[model samples]
Target chain A: MAATTKGDAGRSDMPEAMGAGIRIVAWNVLSLAIALVIWQLASRAVGSPFFPAPMQIVDAFIQLATRGDTTGHSLWEHSWASIERVLVGFGLGVIFAVPLGLLMGLYPKLYAGTRAVIEPFRFIPPIAWIPLAIIFFSGLTRFAFLIFLGAFFPIFTSTLVGVARVEPIHRKVGIVHGASKLWILRHVVIPTVMPDIMAGMRVGLGTAWLTIVAAELAGGISTGLGRMMINYAELIMVPHVIVGMLLIGLIGFLMNEVLLLIERRLFRWRWQVSL
Target chain B: MHAPISLAKVDVDASHRYGPLTVHDGLKFSVAANEFICICGPSGCGKTTLLDMLAGILVPSSGHVHIDGTPANPKKHSISFVFQEPSTFPWLTVSENVATGLNIKGAPSDQVRSKVASIIDIVGLKGFEDYYPHQISGGMKQRVAIARAFATEADLILMDEPFVSLDQPTREHMQREVLDIWRHMKRTVIFVTHNLEEAVYLADRVLILSAKPARIVAELPIPLQHPRDPLSTEFTEIRSKCVQWLHASH
Candidate 1:
């Protein structure tokens, strides 16, 4: 009888927990639905080729995803191409940015001295460099450069901010405990700055996506989703364009979710309060 | 009592545009091995400055803070400190925080684990070892701080108003815990605080100081036993004497 009562209580608690999660998901879906409704109404009222209705967009999306060679390529092929460019460019940016950011963070004097040079370049839009990138690099490299430029600044700046704001008390504690400079940086400073770095990476990922689209349009990269999107626009095929847009949003959301999951797992100590 | 640490004719001075501020002017004192010495003074009277000097976090302009006949060096890690706020790393679990000193020293993993577990248990946080600083109550956080200090195995521990943030009841409870730990470990402690009752409750001797450009005004040795009743006559007498000395100096 006691075991049955305990099991009932456990079952009851599970629903409460699940209810909170469901509420969050429901709220997000409601907002998306409201946005779709607004889009549909606006499109119907205007009745222009540019603004398609939500159902029409959905129908287009299904056609593009299912039909091969909708815009001289399938949706899968286009998505694969876009993912390839973004992954390559973003990977290169991270390789360069992380170490540079760490150096800038660790050595404030060096960072301060170089700020005059780095800050102006950071403000220049990645798309603004399209002409110069074309002049410098050929083919895929030009698009990659634009993507790299787009992703670099946010990650670097966030890393610098994170490293700079490491609590003084934590450093003092490390000193009192006889930690060497390297040990303190690795054990205390790095861990404290990780969440900020992760936030920067998220922002960088968004920037990379935006820049890739512009790069693909400007440079005429033959295989990417961006090229596919432009080609669909040129052909007045609204469905293919909608499909590409949806895929971009979905992929970005999935990437962020993956990072969040990793963050939660690796830094469980940070989120112990919620548990 | 055998003098384990001593300062003689110690002079610390700082000069600004507004003349000079003297922190310790010919300050002379001796602390016996395993003694609980609480230094009490008004705010800005350099009680913390004095503790910092002793801990070797600061260099006195003109004097030396000697530990076991050598100048105190913070880099040596001979003196462990518990600050006004619990200084446990927010990113680390209680056990990891406690084991940090050992980790820095590059002790073997098994030794660090066993020592941390024992210290956590000693601090009455057996089950909460896996908990992070934010997950624990303030009192529990302070307990973890205390456990970390104890676990460091440093012969001399310095504390700067460690219980100043706690409620009165919790503070009193922490005072007892500190005394109990001191009794069992027999480690020399130098505690600095602004609270008269706390100074009386914890110290073998209380050193009262004057206001800024501070100097030691009076040193009162409490002839009380462990687990002292605050209501007792001796406790009241010493407490009043320390308060009076503080007022007179100001």
Candidate 2:
């Protein structure tokens, strides 16, 4: 019976699983539709100015896309402002912290030198840095500082962990092959640590998004998702405020999707094994 | 004709205030150029730890390791190791992993490419040059490990139970592959394993060890030629002799 079942499994599983792509798309559409229907019903029942209907938010979205009335910036411009802060801040954090983390992981002295400073600071939320960041840095630099603080520790800590986690046997392979310490770091340690680094980047970027919203709301930004949401809410444009919040959610989701795509491409070897 | 590597009076102790625990003590051995030697013992008999002391990855509490009759220094001596679990750089393709040692040794570009290609082909990984380690089977990974060992043309090659993790069929195939590579390259090899059959199958000389404090108990030489059949009487006789020595040690 087991032998017959094994023979039948090959014929049964192949064609049905062939179009996984189409099945995924179909499932996603169904899930989204179910969500929208529930949200539409809930909004209509609330019937409050604070809670606008789904259709009202959609209409407000169309209006914002076509015209930038109150702030004199396009909806795209506001979204772009938030995205720019995320990129510059996250980029600065990555460039500065990755190498430092790698170095600290390799050399004990470096880690010992900076451990006291980093351990305390890593615990503080990025939102807490907004007031001090405004004083220390002017305008866009202030927002950048906030985002960088949010992103830096995650990326740095992961890099350190990743480097430390490299198997001893792998390093032994390099040593036995007569590779120098520097050569082993470049060829073996760095490559082995990359997947962990990428995972850290994804997490750090999420924190950057969260911090940017808080920063824009509190730091008195002229144009951004958080600023737009606050400004429209004050003006009693409830639908527009909802539109701003949803836009932020959508844009953050898209950015994460792109990062995941890049990671999947970079680490294709990691997932391709049938064994 | 000269020995490329030798270890004398090596000792590793892990005793506490309460009692005594000596892992290895006074191990003395030598490997002649181009000789394939196997270190066989019961499990946890410090075979791999022995390899580590020889490779300078681990320092024995007291010992002398010599390479080319000089004090052993990794930077001065070229030695290759094939770990029990192959350590191919996950990010590197099969050819790149094969080329790594050669590049570090500063081989010319043309030489690196040809040598890497030839070694990959020799290991029956011709079509897998572009494949990553994760995409291949465990047996294929060990083949790459052996290929890397041979490609560097090191003075000594230390293998720590490289095929013990593999299935019987794959183990037999890899043993043959190792023999084939040894014949072609003619580098000194010290392979460590717990399996007596595996030791008899591959080694020119099997150095059997006692249970703990792990001293070398006996040297059993196999005069059978390459590609020796495991089913043959001569093979079984030698295997039995090695097993008897191990049982006696216990």
Candidate 3:
């Protein structure tokens, strides 16, 4: 009986699973369509300019994409401005944080010595630093400083955790093999901590995105998604503001997806234990 | 055939303490070059601490461990290890893991490549050179660890219950494979385990250690040769002697 059932499983399972998959996708589309219809109806019934319909936002999206915004910067330019700031700030944060984290992890004394200064600043939110950041830095530096403040702690903390979590046995392997201290750092310590560092980077990227948006909105930056949203908000162009918000969401999601892809590629050796 | 590397002769007269708590007191032993020495004891015995001192990872609170007339230092001595836990670097492929020591020693690329290839083949991992540790089974990962230790052609090889994690069949198989590798390579090995049967099966001489503040309670030499049957009278005699020593210490 078991053999017969097993033999039939291959022939019977494929289309049944495929049918379920198709049903799921169809349900997703239907649910989204219903939500959009409700949104459209609510906007019409309210007759408020603030509550723009989905189609109105879509029309605004096309308009912003084809023609320049009020400031003559295309939607792509605004997005590029936001992305460029994020990349610079995030890149700098990773470069500084990972090595410092690794060093601090290896030398507890270093962490101990600096903990007093680092801990308090880490707790202070990056948004709180906007006024000081604007005063201290100008242009890209201001944006980078704010974003760096947001991104730095997560990457650094996780890398520290990664170092702490490094298996003593693995380090013992290096020691027994007579590997030099630098070689152990490069080969054993770095590789062991990579997955943790990658996880930290993912979190840091999200924080960086949020920090850049807030900085752009408040720092009086001339060209960014947040800046464009503010411009529309002042003019009572709610649809364009919605377009900016959605664009921010879409871009943030895509950046996260890219980092996730890289994480998967980097840690292919990680064991996947299933119950 | 290439010349076999000179094996290390170890001499230990060490006592270790942890914050006023003694782990091993006056634990003295010596391993001859090319000898297979297994140390077994009850749980909480300082078998691993002994290995750590020999590997130069920890210094004894009193006395010293010497390898070939000098103080034991991993940097000064040629040593390799197979740990109780899975210690293969997950980022490296099988070939690279095997090649770790040689690469660290700054051996020429060709030498490393050949040594890694031959050792991988010896361990029956030839087809899996590109595979990572996580891609392999538990037994296979241990095999990789074993191959890596041998590939270094180190003078002293320390294994702390390298096969304790495997089930019965795989453990038995690995025991035999390890014996063959030791016979072929002829390095001084200090293997630590808690299993009496495993020690009896593998060691030239089994060192039964007493419980904490651990010291060698008994030495049971297996007069039986390689591929000795566990059912054989001498094999059982040696195993029971080790068990007796363990029970007496407790």
lDDT of 2 by residue, B1-250 (tens): 1232432222223211113667776766676667788898888877777787667666566656666666555566777888887688778778888888898899999998988888888888887787777667778888888888878777778899898779998888888888888787777788998888888889889988887777778988899997888899999999999999999877
Deviation of model 3 at B14, angstroms: 2.1
Residue-level lDDT for A196 in candidate 3: 83
lDDT of 1 by residue, B1-250 (tens): 1123332212223311123666666656767767789989888887767777777777777656777666777665466789886688888888899988788878899988988898887778887776667777898898888888878677788898999889888888788888887777777898999899888888989988888667778989988887788899989988999989999988
Give TM-score, chain B, model 1.
0.90
Ranking, lDDT, top scorer first: 3, 2, 1
lDDT of 3: 0.87
Model 2 chain A scores worst on lDDT over the 10 consecutive residues at A1-10
The TM-scores of all predictions, comma-separated, are: 0.87, 0.86, 0.89
Candidate 2 chain B, run of 10 with poorest lDDT: B9-18
**A1-275: candidate 1 lDDT, tens digit per residue:** 11112222223355566888899999999999999889989999999887788888778777777885544677788788777778888888888887788889989999999889999999899999999998899766776788899999998999988998888878877777677899988998889888877788888989999998888777445677778878888898876687778888888788778777777766766632121
What are the runs in model 2 whose C-alpha is more than 4 Å off?
A: A1-18, A37-50, A107-116, A272-275, B1-21, B229-237
- All candidates: DockQ: 0.33, 0.42, 0.46
Residue B201 of model 1, lDDT score:
86
Residue pairs in steric clash, candidate 3? none
Local accuracy by lDDT, each model: 0.78, 0.80, 0.87
Name the lDDT value of residue A45 in candidate 3: 100
